[model samples]
Target: MAHWNFSLLFGSAVLWAMLIPCRAFPTGAPASACENMLPVHTGVQPQPTRAPYEFLLSSPSFLNGQPINIQILGPAYKGLLLEARSFGSNAALGIWKTPPNNTKFLQCSGNPHGAVTHSNTNLKTRQTTYTWLPPNSGCPPVVMFIATVAQSREIYWTNVKSKVIWKNPKATCGAQMLTRTWPAAALLSSMLLILLVYL
Candidate 1:
């Protein structure tokens, strides 16, 4: 009877150990390294200058956050910084063009001549547009746009879920992959521990 009770207790401990890794190492990909690093505003959320623009992609859908060419149609100026932030949390995602100065979370990874590449006007309609290519990895499910004026440090942010594009196929794969291996590893460890305890 004592031996049986010991085995049950040991097995329970091993099972608990197995669960720790699943929680510690999250299978889901984080939106960014600097996710939710920015200061939160307690006051009312600010309104955007105009309706959020559309994000046009070459492909109908993205795979595992793969790098894709994109174009934007909206109000953009020469000095304003076009940044992508995770929806709701507003964590810095990526910039269309590197800013003259880096934000708390965003690095200057944008093209120096980004304004020229991003901003163009239609000669016929006088509408301004921009183009950007987000990084190939670490993309969240959804993101919103922010137009930041460098000189005045003013920010114009789109409404939450304003522009939804790009989902990571790896988000599903990572979890499944971890589940496949984790059980095997945990079983092996548990068996070894049980054997040692019996001996």
Candidate 2:
């Protein structure tokens, strides 16, 4: 009986240890983990200049070519345009605007404009959400998001900038993918082997 209990306890400990890392590192882990790997942007004021329209923008401080989540909050406007552009050259990369216009002004990086993957707007609360996939190749170290609003025939704009950290998908995602699955696989195999031996 004591030997059986000891085996069970050992198996339980192994199972518990495997679960800790998965919970600690979630699928959408923050970029803070790679902060030291990227260049530090210092001596620049952190706060963005306020625009005529009241708004709030939420985005990660560091990007690793993952789909970026962008949220905008402000008063309801007649029209809203969100754009992603190269940091210094003002070259467009992607755009999301109301009315679905495909004019020359909407072109991205001299290429034809492409629509945003997902977009949602709540007029009552005046909030908007957008998902953007930045180009993996030839992308700059930093990118800017420009949110423009047209309210009552007047235009208001806000800018939010993010740092881009290049991560080889094969390396980063592959390792994380293994990390997420390896523990579960090992746990199952260990539990089955233990059962076969003990029973």
* TM-score of each predicted structure versus truth: 0.37, 0.41
| RMSD values, in order shown | 24.1, 26.8
Error of 2 at 3 (Å): 99
Q: Distance from true position, residue 103, model 2, in Å?
A: 14
- Report the C-alpha lDDT of model 2 over 62-113, residue by residue, as the tens digit: 2445565665455654434455665455455633333222111233344444
| Candidate 1 per-residue C-alpha lDDT over 95-176 given as tens digits, one digit per residue, 9 for 90 to 100 | 3433122211223333232222112111211143343444455556654444432111133342322245545544331222
Task: Give the Cα error of residue 132 in candidate 1, in Å.
Answer: 4.5
- On TM-score, the candidate that comes out on top is 2
Cα-based lDDT at residue 70, candidate 1: 46
Judge candidate 2 against the unseen true structure and give its global Cα lDDT, from 0 to 1: 0.43
Which residue pairs show backbone clashes in model 2? none
Each candidate's lDDT (Cα)? 0.39, 0.43
Best by lDDT: 2
